[model samples]
Target: MIGVLIVLCSLHTGFAVTHTGKGCVTGSTGVRDLPEFVAVLMLDEETGAYFDSKTRELQIRLEWALNKVNDSQKYIHYFNVLISSAIPDLMNALQFAMSLYGHSGGIHTLQIMLGCEVSEDRKAGEFMKFGYDAEDFISLDISTLAWIAHSPQAGIICADWNNHIETAQFWKGILENECFALLKKLVEYDREILERKVPPEVSLLRRDPSSPVTCLATGFFPEGIVVSWQKDGEDLHEDVELLETLSNEDGTFQTRSRLTVSPADVKEHNYTCVVDHSSLEKNIIKPVTEEEIKTNQDPENSLPVGIIIAVVLAVLLVAIAAFAC
Candidate 1:
């Protein structure tokens, strides 16, 4: 089985840092036997960017203002370096951590989150954690690497490592001296752009444009948008499937809401797709028309019509042949 390594970074108006990297190794049988691990360098509510190791492609494009900054390139270069250097250690740590769990091969996840939150008062709180699935194996706070929390038995091993004083000290130093340093600089540099909010361009689409239509609301921003199908004035919940929100290349988001409707319902009912987002002062409503529905119906659904026509032709041919005979 192939492993996936994902790296993410985001900076928000409050200067919060959310940097996380995760790697998962799977067994040959497509089972996850090796531990999955996530390492974070920073947390926040802003749109984040993803870097695919295999493709080496950045999913989100940099804002124009960000592109104009000289340090932006330096920042991106540093991010690349951090991910490259940390991934190996994270993978090794995952393998070692998995071994300690007494399992050679199975699906397990290890996550590390490194974060810094600065209050309006200029006081900063830094946080870091190492966890397996939902269980926190170790946690630390502040620049001194003070032990704030840990798992019951896992705390023993964590404490031992802290006593040696390298791991915790390293993260504390990096978070305070390096990560926060960069965060402050980047936040100040991109303050205007970071504070600016761009509303998404909402588009309603049909999967088949016909009966049993799947409605898609795409190109929304800030990751907060409501998409639903409605009949008349009431909302629809039955036969509705809402897919997960997907991130666009521009850091906006897209989601799909599917509705199943019959031909009779299309003719009698007024169906609409309603979208609400922070960017919009009022909800955007797109009505579904009968013509649109009929125009978009699946071509496969016309198979019965074709079959009927063929049968009629065959019967006419048989009658003609009999008369001539």
Candidate 2:
């Protein structure tokens, strides 16, 4: 049987590795002169929200595997396994592990599960073909072939993220790619939710002084949703006031953003609290009830009748000149 590497994706919660500095033996590459097996594990940083009992079991299984491999000196003598954190990309983890071990050459495997609909394991056709043909590969999931066509290389194998390398492929060599992907997802999701008519029970609370609204909103998914206040359709400085949002029992969040805005400046100004959500995107414009009246105000919203006529005549003259030309 091929060597098995088990990867558990629950390390986003973080595991305390007892590094003895003596070097733990994982397994051998089975070579007489140089035998090294680089362990690479890919864990999603954003999946911290989905921790459950199943993931805990998987984590325990990984630790057991590591202990068993390290304890057995007869089959795999003097092999070393090191743990690396913050490796989100599959390929980058491979390169980094291989480099860290000072090995001349080795292949790093990854676990493949499409969190999205287009994950390589989604279909058996061009997507799978394109995914595998891209490189020397290993499929961590055994059930993938069940969904895909006949392929000899890619097979299901259980692996742990703590002490295992992955067979999955990522687009870049850095976790930043996934981070950016996540950011894009967040921004897009925010837009999507905020566009809804219900407005996601979200609202931006701006302060009159504009000192920066720093307050916690307690009431839905405090972390899942954004609570911010705005004026003139621009983001308020976060440093001016930081917000602490708290979630409610009903899974709603109430965010309080406290800011000290100049009451004189914004007394009757139309400042709006805009919320960009996944399903609701409506903004609640605060009523300018305090209404400011400038005694000597030069109206920018309207033009004098003589000025309008003069501007129209000038435009007409320009149009006629262009036509004549």
Candidate 3:
């Protein structure tokens, strides 16, 4: 019996190592390219980002399963591979990727790597909000895939939506639990900001005390909201700021927020922005400023509230659109 081990090469790519699956040790393709008979599970999410030890475990699980299917144990053979990070449309994403693998008619295996849990109303902007602000700490990507069950010649491993460490003991429990909590915070915070009648200034930026991240956050609330940065929850940027509180095309009331920090604050304080709004249940996240990010190298970006939701919704529609809708 040939043994096949499919390892996750990166966020959007996987490699198939076969020893017992067939007379193989044969298919060793480059990372960016692949042979015709192998199916690659590309994990695009973890590729550019740093996944701590816990999330890395999830990737490993997917790797183990990939090996099983390709081994001589009698899963499908002679299929190509499709690698991607976030599935734009679960079904469409799956189907489209599979077409490359030659299993488009009805794929035997469909896997998902879930990093965040979303409410029914998940959107692109909201989906990306956490990823945007999650400097090296925020959780916005998948931790692992689960193979719930299978048949004689086939099986399935996917993203477990109802992941629970219940008491602990969940698969890769540490990664799933913490990452889930962080993503939820983003949704809750956004909803609060949206509801505020007199929403205070809000800025979301990333400044690493270890090393600053130089990426400007995009503010697209459609509410004419201004955003900036702070340190120790204190406001930043006067000489080093871009204060732009403009009139909306419709001319409503949008509050101003700025993001700024000093070298001392960056080195010593845990500064964050605090926007006091009448509509929000509480203050939203303390955002970073341009200066804070300018000196930093691994600058974290914030995803405004509109885009992530759109991407997630699109992906949901593709996978089980009928069920999703």
Candidate 4:
């Protein structure tokens, strides 16, 4: 017997330019620490609304979300009613999944992720997927409007759902039209904040003089930027690793590029970290010098002089770009 079970959908939101609305519903049983049922809503990867069985209420996470809606209270009430009506069906589905898995007890979860996105090119797409125990069980093919099963147990479920063609059509309409429209409206309501650009703070970091040099750029907006390492005015791709761009808590971005070279060789050659972004008039070029490398050995006073000047210039350039925009 399984002692407890919980399931939740995997959700990743988009950048500021491409607006989106993501929602997930979860059902669980015999979980002391978790709610029996929970639902969450996100706009552009930020929590816009939330609900749980304990509260039985649709609550807003962002204040501006309810401002532009024509019938604010009615809209809130509609979601409350919708989620309340959906809970029983969700519970039944959870039990059916548990039975299929042959789990009589323990913590188990069934999660559903559904969302819509409108890209910068105005191309729009939607998705709906189901998971059990944090693994994919089934997903909907928005292009064909059919369910695709990922596991043997989901085959029967998909077959049953596919028979109801009208229901699929109804959800398609809601996702593409209703959901897309609401996401676009939310972006419109916060255009100023969404469109604003903030420059990155660049730093050169290393564990010690013998360690690989790492160029860290953080707190930039729009998520579009380039980081490269150059040696003596030539591109140096070998022994250089450029990491993926990551999102910051404030809706900004951060990235890193590391260069591996012996300390003696680094001193002989001029290695520079080049950063390019829309917010800058010119690319930021910082040479890898011992004086400019922040070290963990003396973190408190290790602020590099080169990085300090680069940050000041970056702010001025970003200010100029903002004025031009």
Candidate 5:
């Protein structure tokens, strides 16, 4: 996995305006013995894109965003080139770094992170920017070759190729004009898709006659769902265990709540599983009863028993025909 941290801040009308963007590139060997890349780009934690080499698809906001673009083929081509061009260099750098560290052969990761932070006040302006490969500490400055930090070679690298003044000025322009411009465009494009919500598929299950009653909610999007157990129209807090929300492969979420009840209590009180989510206009309430439990536990028994009687009658008719013949 690749991790990048970026921070940009500006002073406008006596308030600080901050913008951040992160880009990640990950590569792994696949079944075809070829390297595969997964590239993720994020802007201010609101808009993001993921390109998967194995699927050859680019997904944005849990949907295929490439199809929505005007020139989808061109967009795909650009992303493919951007990701594929970086794989070999990154892998080679990682292998070299691993050798230096005395590590051999298994899956290794090389990460490159680029960040820029600028903060300004009335009297002074400050800017910080860095790009580095995490594995070997080979880093980049505005006008310097990749050099190991804190090593003897670092002094030579600084003296020979340092262009701190020009590099800093260029980065300032890029951060304000290019990076922030892309962020604004992405946020505007993805506004509607990001706001879309999906309702939860609520279900109640009792796997065995003696097992605890489980209330399951799956396929819910946006992650702000509440599942609770209620008895006789009142919420029950005791003897209830709620599991963590787990992510589905399709970008939805699932969670379950377990309620422990004695046989006497089950007979005496009515139980229900209640779900509340933003997607639902009204709360969903699914009542749990002894009959529902029995049905869930033994659903196959509900098939028609008359089919057996019909088979027996058919067999007798055949036997009588045989005897007459």
Candidate 6:
């Protein structure tokens, strides 16, 4: 049997410390752009280490993560052992799942995701779920320690997992105790970097005279922020589109709020972009004037080519929408 493997890591929003691990296996080889097997470890949003089947060696990516542990070799060995054993199990499970669904002659992927989080108020959460072909298959309800099958194909696996009470307990123990402890320790080790705030560089942008005015704030840290529009010193809610905050490669964040109004209205009315962030002493107020608005059409006010490139790069770097609501 031929197969492939993939791993992904992500962080949760509003949590003081978050750790997530994911593994994926495919039933056939020759899958474009996928490795045979891979494993990655992350602390918050930063990758600490990674291992791939091709290299067959664990590589520490973060200096702090390496320094935090006394026995780096032992830590690496532990993950190597876990991943070495899991590869075959994941492949077999994927094959089994595919067979159960009567799937054949094409690549099929099975993914396992597990994570834990600790909030500022001492609240905690844990999750473990499986997906097939990018759709939910089964999940573990940590509250009840039961397996919930999302599809008919997952029923057998669910029943089998639910019967193994010890397995659930094992995960519960790690998530509640070991995982929490590790995350806290890591957070403490990197507290300065994680907690430090950076103010945003705000700008006003528009594509043309007829386009909606965009108020963009970039290079901010700690994520929590608000971008709003105002007209004549009062809040303007109508014809406004506030976009979700996006992550940047430098661990900062960027967001924008757009106001749709006619050129005539814009020229006649006083409009401004209000930005509120934890790092700022006071809110940033940027007036949307013709002279201040960057545009591609207007030669004198054309947006800087470098800034446009940065915006495109930021959009591409968005692996997932870190915040939802």
Q: State which candidate has the highest TM-score.
A: 6
Q: Model 4 reaches what TM-score against the true structure?
A: 0.67
What TM value does model 5 have? Answer: 0.56
Residue pairs with backbone overlap in model 6: 5-36
Pairwise lDDT winner, candidates 1 and 3: 1
lDDT of 3: 0.29
lDDT of 2 by residue, 50-92 (tens): 1111121111112222343434443122211101111123334
TM-scores for the candidates:
0.64, 0.27, 0.20, 0.67, 0.56, 0.69
lDDT, each prediction: 0.48, 0.28, 0.29, 0.67, 0.49, 0.62
Mind sharing the TM-score for model 2?
Answer: 0.27
Q: Write the per-residue lDDT of candidate 4 for residues 1-325, one digit (tens) a residue.
A: 1112211232343455676666666777878877777766555534455667778787664555556566777777766666666667677778888988888889887777767787763647888777787789888787788988999988977888788776567667767776677667666677765677778888999998788888988888766889999999999999998877765645567888889889998879999999999888889988999888889531232111000001111112221221122
lDDT of 2: 0.28
Over 4 Å off in model 2, which ranges?
1-199, 203-211, 214-260, 276-278, 287-325
Provide backbone clash counts, one per model. 12, 57, 55, 12, 0, 1
Give the backbone clash total of model 3.
55
Q: Which candidate is the best by lDDT?
A: 4
Every model: Cα RMSD to truth: 19.8, 24.9, 19.7, 12.4, 20.6, 9.4
How much is the lDDT of residue 294 in candidate 1? 34
TM-score of 1: 0.64
Give the alpha carbon lDDT tens digit for every residue of 1-325 in model 6: 2211222224345543433322222323346656555545455555455555667676665565567677778867766665555556556666677787998747666655555566552536777666677678887788889989999878977788788877677667766775566566666667786778899999888888889888888888777899988899999999999886766656677878889999988788899899999999999999988888888531232111101001111111111111000
